[model samples]
Target: MSPTDILRLLLKNWKLLLAVPLALGGSLFYFTRHEAKSYASETTIYTGIASGYSLTGNSESDYFRTSNAFDNLLSLIKSRETKEQAACYLLASHLQLKELDATQLSWASLSRMRALLPAALRRQLTGPTLAATQRNVTAYASANDTNELYRLLNSHDPVYSVEALGKVNATRINSSDLIKLELETEDAAICRATLALTTQVFLAEYRSLRMSQTAAVIRYYEVESEKALKRLNDAEEKFLVFNRDNNIINYYEQTKYIAGEREYLYSDINKIEMQYAGALASLAAVDKKLAGRGASLLSSAELLRQRKHLESLNTEIANQQLFARQQETDAAPRTQQLQVQAAETVLAIRTTLNDHYAQLNSVEGIPSKGLLDEWVKNMLEATENKAKLEVMGRRKGEFMAEYHKMAPLGAMLKRIEREIDLTQKTYFALFTSLNDSKASQQNNELTTNLKIVAPPFLPSQDKGGKRLMLVAGGAFGGFFFVAATLLGMGLLDKSLRMPAVAQAQTGLPVLGLLPAHPTHPFKKTKKPAQASKLRDHSYEHAAAEHLARQVLRRVSAVPARPFVAGVLSPLRQEGKTTVVQSLAHSCNAGGLPTLALYPEGTDAGPANDYTRYYSPAQATLHRWNLAELTQPRAADVQLVLIEFPALLEATYPVTLFPELSLVLLTLKASRSWKPTDQQAVADLRAATAAPVEIVLCGVARYDSTDLIIPIEKSKTA
Candidate 1:
């Protein structure tokens, strides 16, 4: 279609385009109304940290920590633990969980309580599973965020989802500043109990954590002190042993005595050695003389030599005796010298060994104050007997120093022991007192430091929004659906709706345009048999005749004298016959002498002389040859409407009628009637004996109105 044509079509069908989406939206709204209404009431809770307990000096850290801490607590409230706790609390008060368990519980049973709870309750608790269908899924309220308390309350059951224990359905309603805790059950009292129990549990948990923290600090310090005391005791024991066994005491004196003893023992032995040597010399001389006397008596050769040796030995023996006599004299210088030398050697050795003797004579020589071995033995004996008074006295002094230093530890140990005893006593007392206080608090229903700022109120109607939003949501959904449908239709459309699109494919000028009828001609109907038959006849007769009237009118309006109008399109079934008849009638209506002609087919076929409506007064309608038109006719018709079917024969131009005002060809909009189809019409125009104008017929309509038309009855009848 041309841009003008497209714009016209859009303008005409604007309501249809909009209605599709609107209807979808309406349907969505209608269906959503069946869903249950959820209402919420919220009470604002300002959780504050007390003055003395905070460390950041009124900073938001306390609030931040509280928010974090409460997040876990809030989760715990909606947890199965909280559910069981709530159920137990309710049970304790003679209220039953049978109703709640039946409606709100999941279908899965807890393995821990499956055996304990009744079989009916087991069915109430369901294991989480994927939804079989998309619609069966339920939404969840976030357990971490505590800004809304109603989420906690509503989240306990799918009938409602909550933000917190005391706040429920706040997101679904107005007046959001308040944390509304909604109880969705039919019972009002149960809702109140659930809220109250949740608050009490939160307080209990907070206090328990506080006490544990304080006790942990004290226990950590006590353990560290115990380890320190153990190390200190070990150090003191080591120091005591080191001081008593001082290895360096009297060391120099004992070394000196040892040096003196070594010299005396070695030097005294040299003096006696010289006296023994002299005695040995005198005995040698006497033995030699006795042997020589035996030798002198023998006169043989052996005896003569022996006598000579004996004589010499007797003389030496006398000299040795004299010498021995001199050496034996105490006053003899040599003997005196020897004695003195011995004495001097002994003295020198003693001098060399002086330090050794001093060591021997030192106090270490004393039994009580001896070397290490002796002292150790003695100390051991003394300790066993408790008899060495001096050793005991020194020991007492050493022990006293250590004892004094360690005395504090002993006192501390005793103190810690006392503290432990006291703590044990206090622990018992505190435990008893705490139990009593707890009992009293429970009995009195005392308000804890953690107070509930706002109690859950019974909703008048409901604090949440109603089903209108669902309707709006459905409307939005419907709008998208319609848009999707239109976009899909546009995308899938392959038929040529625009002339430019066809021209782009094949560069052919659109010679003429046949707008779609105000009403669509081809559509199924639910009319009665008579009405259908009437409608069919009207289309065949009146509608066909109308086309012939338009054809004649177009031919006369051409700029050239006696202009020929050709009705043509891309394919068949585009009402060329109808256009031709309509044009003829239009010419006749205008009081012009007109003739309707059908082109002759080759070989004298049915196209050569096809009969149209017979008329006695007006011009006869007949198939005429191209050769026959060039020749003169019986009368000079001012207007001639030619009806030509699209033919693809090569000899079609030769068969074209002569003196043709215009070549009129017709084809359907569907099929392969592209720009090439226009070439067929252009082919006839080129072969015409005269100038030719092309006219298109049978455009399809987008609506029913475009295809309907009024019927015209024949006046000649």
Candidate 2:
């Protein structure tokens, strides 16, 4: 359907569209009449989640972190625990009230609470002051989940419940750190009080939560720091014990001194060997001068004993110098004693050798005194050198042994030092982390910046109810809904509601349209004059006259004696009888002798001069011969309009097709064309060579006007 068709349909049902919306809107207004006026309270808070100064210094804002922070803040504000606490506080304040105070609660709300709370329970819970009442309420609420205070907070009551407090809305103002909180309730005092309490509770809870988080982190870092410190101390203690047990002080330095002393001792031994060799050679030459006497003197017991004693003292001093611990290096007295004993032994040996030489006489008996003196000095030098060589050799062996022992000690010491170094680094790292955590905790404390910029105030004026807006919305909504429903029905409808629609559906040219009229053309009425006036000026009469003229023009080409036009329909009640009667009247008025024939049961009231009902039995016997059926009126009739039974219900009389000049298919404008109707029309066309034109009856006035306009214009032209 076109938009024009839809517009026409809606306009035709304008009264229904108006009535439905008005009725729906009226009902809505009446039902919402008792809606109470609302009171609103708003508070603004400075929540520094995105841009805030802290002990940690200002940092660049992170979109994700700031978003998360705001999310957390909003979640905290809406949290059940926070609201419950606020509700508890509000309830405690109310409980402490001795009488209804406008500042605290409205009279109706106070009265409602009194009625809800038993007098005995109320007295038990109430206290002289707000603080005492809060304590009492807390204690009572904690006693059980089924307590009155608990139940009240959990219930859906509009004043003291957590659910009620959920109405408080917290939103960040644009991208700023400020938050706007709003709430509306039936009572102004309740609205203001709820918002105020909720803000306080949310701030306290947020601060506590932030502090707790930082505190937990600080505690963890502190624990790790303590562990790190203990590890460091343990490493140091191990090192200390290792040093004590190993008898070491500055192990590297002690080893270096030992190595230097060992090298010096080896060099001294080399020098002493050179001296002993030279002295021995000299002694040998002197001995050659004193031959057997020198040999006997060197073999003397005292001399041998002195030399052995000197070697023993030197060995002891060398051992002390080469192998003594660093702590033992302070034994200077003992070292000096050992060196003195060695020197004294060397002197005794020299004296004994001198005495032996002095008492000796040259075997050759030539300058014996000088020879003997030289021999004694050389003998003492050789003896002392030999003793030093022996001590130095032993010290070299001890030095090598000490060095080998210190190798493992060096590795162990390095391992211990490495442990201490690692532990020390760990300690410092944990200590730094602990300090950072402490700083963060301090920053959190400083940045708990929930400041109320605009505190909630009691609303004085009542915010009017939304009754008018709701009523208007309902009316508009109902109007749209009804319009949409009608449009959907129209789109889905397949009714041939217009002459164009009938022509399109049946693929037949429309002769004309017959507008729906209240007055039946065949029915006799008490007031004939009024009926005549109705038929004369009515659109239906004009449409019928036009349709009859079109049919006459088509049948004028037929060579039959009396032009027979068959009025047929797909189904009964398609106004086939009406069309036939109207066509006959139109023809008779136009000076054409017209005869109208219908089925036996048709309501063609008492046979008139131009109208008659035909017998089905005779028509069937005569094979629907128009001449045979209308033989009696054939002489007076120039145009015969025969109304056939619905073709879908009864078979078409193919015998009558040869006698008919034209066939008018009368289709109701409000009825859909079915497949059977199309098939019946096809069959009727095959049975006759006459032109089968469409006559749309019961058409809406607008559709009828559309069809009549062209005709009227053509006639005028």
Candidate 3:
């Protein structure tokens, strides 16, 4: 079929196609309104390190290495711990636990508990059907008792699903970082509360874990202080034992030993004391020193000499303290080393002192022996006690040196210790607080990390009420459906829908078109009103007639005469007779002399219906019995259009219309001309021995131009 024909068909059946989408869309829109409204609430979570420390070195570097803050936060949102908390919160607040308990009570007992027991029991129970015993009981009730209870017992009952608004339903949505949470409860306040509570608990739990690292640091310092204190005590005890072993007391023996063993140390101390006296003397000697030779004595080199002398004196004092320790342990290595070294050097000096003493003793003529011994004993005992005191005094000096060192470090140590102690206490206290917080928070709930950016709210108005969607969708679907239907119709249609196909089928020059009318042929009218009718009473019926008459009017240009136009079809029932009648009617109506020669072999020919108009239509209607054509009856007639059926019996009767212009007739979208029908038209035209112009009949309404092809215009002679 031509595309226009296909479009026309779609236009014709548009309503049916439109009906499907309209019905479906309307039903959908209507049902959607009745659907229950859903509400949603959400909370956001931000997980992070709560520790505020920014320490340096290995400790600071290692802190972030093992911590998986991002991953742990992700896990926290999906954890069953969170879900269980959520479930418990929802169940306690929204679920129908109380109603469940109510349901557990026996129905009979519940009915009996109320004063309306018998009446309630009758309503709760449904009478059975299809049982003889039950039917008998029902019949007895109907006959004997006509009360409300009787009716209730007999009536078939319906059980309704409880309308509990507190049921909770959880739904998770599509974001990985966020959860689209929803609870099914009628109360909007409850939904918001549930979400809020869940979030609070989760934060409590999350913050407790946040400070764990800081708590660990505080605990470590407490452990180190105990170890340092123990080490200090052990060192002090060993030092005390060494002091007791040596019989040493004061610094006097230490000073004597210092003077005898190192003479330069004593010489240096005497020189320092002398310089103090000299500096006083130099108070008046500056003017004398101002002279060239005296200036040399006050030069930097001279000052260095004096400073070295003063440093030697301080060294001598330090040696005196060491000497006291050695006096008690004279036989010990510390003492023996000092004595051996000093004795070797001082032996020469002692020999000289002894010679001087021996000379004195000789001059005194040898004192008594016990008096010398007693004097030596007194000196030795006094020296021993002095050495013991010196030993004690040196130890005290050592302690004082250590105290000086410790004094500076002591403040630092105490500060560190205090910090360590404070940190330890904070660690324990914070840990304990965390535990307490966790226990309380275990019952408390918090929102998950995922939160809905936009919670579902009760809309003030539904988006378009779905009606506009219904209409638009209906229109779109209907358009496609109609297009598809027309496409299918075009493919399956075997009848010639285009004028070209009709020409190809029968070798006819398509002359005209006739539209199909939905109205009866007699009831048709003009115009937009014409779209409603089943049949065309005016234009369509006259179309074929007008086409034939126009062909006859052009016969002078034809190459042959006794022109014959045959309205024909491949099938017997194709509307060929109707075309023939319409053709004859137009010619007759136009005042053209026309005779519809009805050949007798087939009752299906168009002239059979026109028999009443001709006086000799009945007698000469048989095959080879055209008495009117042979008679002198048509000399004045300008043209004649014949009705010849495509029959085998009529194929040989061509002599009556010799030198004839043969025109073949067909209807648009009607039965196509078969091969035999085509051959019959060709044989009749060829047998007439004439040039024939085939005429197509009844092309579709839009294709009148295609029905006729214009011949070339003649030039002026």
lDDT of 1 at 434: 50
Instruction: Specify the highest-TM-score model's number.
Output: 2
Q: Rate the local accuracy (lDDT) of all candidates.
A: 0.42, 0.82, 0.44
- Stretches of candidate 3 off by over 4 Å are 1-10, 14-35, 38-92, 96-471, 491-495, 500-508, 518-546, 558-561, 599-638, 646-660, 667-717
Against the true structure, candidate 2 has what lDDT?
0.82
Q: Write the per-residue lDDT of candidate 2 for residues 1-717, one digit (tens) a residue.
A: 688988887997788899988998999999998998899999999867788877756745999999888898999999888888888888888888888899888999999988878889889988888888878877887789998888988899988888998899989999999999999999999899888888988888888998999898888988988898988999999999999998889999988988877777778878889998999999989988877756777789998787777667766765565445423566567879998887787677667766766443576666666786686678667766776677667767887898888878999999999999998998898899888888888887778857899999999999999999998999999889888988989899899888877788889999987876635565678998998777766666678767877877865766565788888988889888888777776788778888888888888667866778877666766685776777567476778888888887865456787777788898888889889988988888888888898988888777765677544455578
How do the candidates rank by TM-score, highest first?
2, 1, 3
Between candidates 1 and 2, the one scoring higher on lDDT is: 2
The best candidate in terms of lDDT: 2
Clashes of each: 95, 0, 28
420-475 per-residue lDDT for model 3 (tens digits): 56556655665665555554343222322233355444322222344556557766
| TM-score per candidate, chains pooled | 0.46, 0.87, 0.42
Least well predicted 10-residue stretch by lDDT in candidate 3: 157-166
lDDT of 1 by residue, 503-577 (tens): 344344333334444123323357757655674455343444345454545555765444444444344455555
Off by over 4 Å in 2: 138-151, 227-231, 293-377, 397-408, 521-538, 555-561, 634-636, 651-653, 710-717
Model 2 residue 487 CA deviation (Å) reads 0.8
**lDDT score, residue 9, model 2?**
77
